[model samples]
Target: MTIEKTETINITSPLDIETVEKLHAGDRVLLSGVIYVARDAAHKRLVHALDQGEELPFDPKGQTLYYMGPSPAPPGRKIGSVGPTTSTRMDSYTPRLLAAGVRAMIGKGSRSAEVRESIKEYKAVYFVATGGAGALLHRTIKNVEPVAYEDLGAEAVLRLLVEDFPLIVANDIYGGDVFEQGRAEYRRGGN
Candidate 1:
């Protein structure tokens, strides 16, 4: 499919259902604004808190979660080598988060069938941050502060303020899956 010059979109965080519904798999996005960071350990804690009906550090509604575990900041930097983790690791907890009002997620790799269903059901979207591009990605991050699960170290939940954070829509509310389409195209030797 040929993309038009206006296909790329620039968006800010705390995306609502209407904005997420407008996105489609394979669309390029330049996202700015606040996003929450969490990985395996942090997800576990959040899910546990939800199960126990405890208050979470941040509201999930209209929020975006980046599946990442960043390395410690060196000296004067706001962060270190921050990159996306394999999204599948968080699959078990994703539906709960989506149900709790998380509207978007950033990570690498394909997600489970259940998660995709939840995305459609919740009118949410999933985005892919390029893997192995930590250094470049870090440059887009303007600030970072730990928000919860501090004892988890690199796995702690963090609030990040980013400007023009790059991403590709991997899954969209309309049920598009870029990973599947890309694989099919490659199998047919179609660029």
Candidate 2:
């Protein structure tokens, strides 16, 4: 489904810090605000930044990071078809990111054990977008600008203003995981 991008939304729902810590698997959300963009390369750079005691390019506290590497947009488009990439590749850097104050991650697949535990410990959430549904996601994005790390190709960081973009919680701080639930619902030759 496509939703036309309209007014820029400001997500002011302080997201009850306690409730945010309990976001559950299969829950849907309308992210009416800003989020940071990061990918495999940017994750590496961030860890190194931590090692050097440098401030992250953006604040992680109460912030969400979308794990993606987008295709260049064609003329007249705010951004190319953008969607979350597989997330397991980010496992190594996630604990560190969580420690640095990140409260959520948006991506396509399930997180590793270490990442999931960190979410539990840090009061964080993991949201999921439709896999392979880039064209549809693009309709929700109205503009694009980078905050940092511009030399890493599409892996460079960028900020996007999105409106009512659809997503489902894949993992939450409460130890629930959607992938497991989905798998349990379906089995070999079974629906």
Candidate with top lDDT is 1
Clashing pairs in 1: none
Error of 1 at 188 (Å): 3.9
Tell me the whole-model lDDT of each prediction, alpha carbons only: 0.92, 0.81
TM-score per candidate, chains pooled? 0.94, 0.89
lDDT (10s digit) by residue, model 2, range 60-103: 78778889988997897768888899999999999999888887
Off by over 4 Å in 2: 2-16, 188-191
Q: Which ten residues in a row have the lowest lDDT in candidate 1?
A: 1-10
120-157 per-residue lDDT for model 1 (tens digits): 99999999998988988888899998899888998999
Cα distance off (Å), candidate 1, residue 122? 0.4
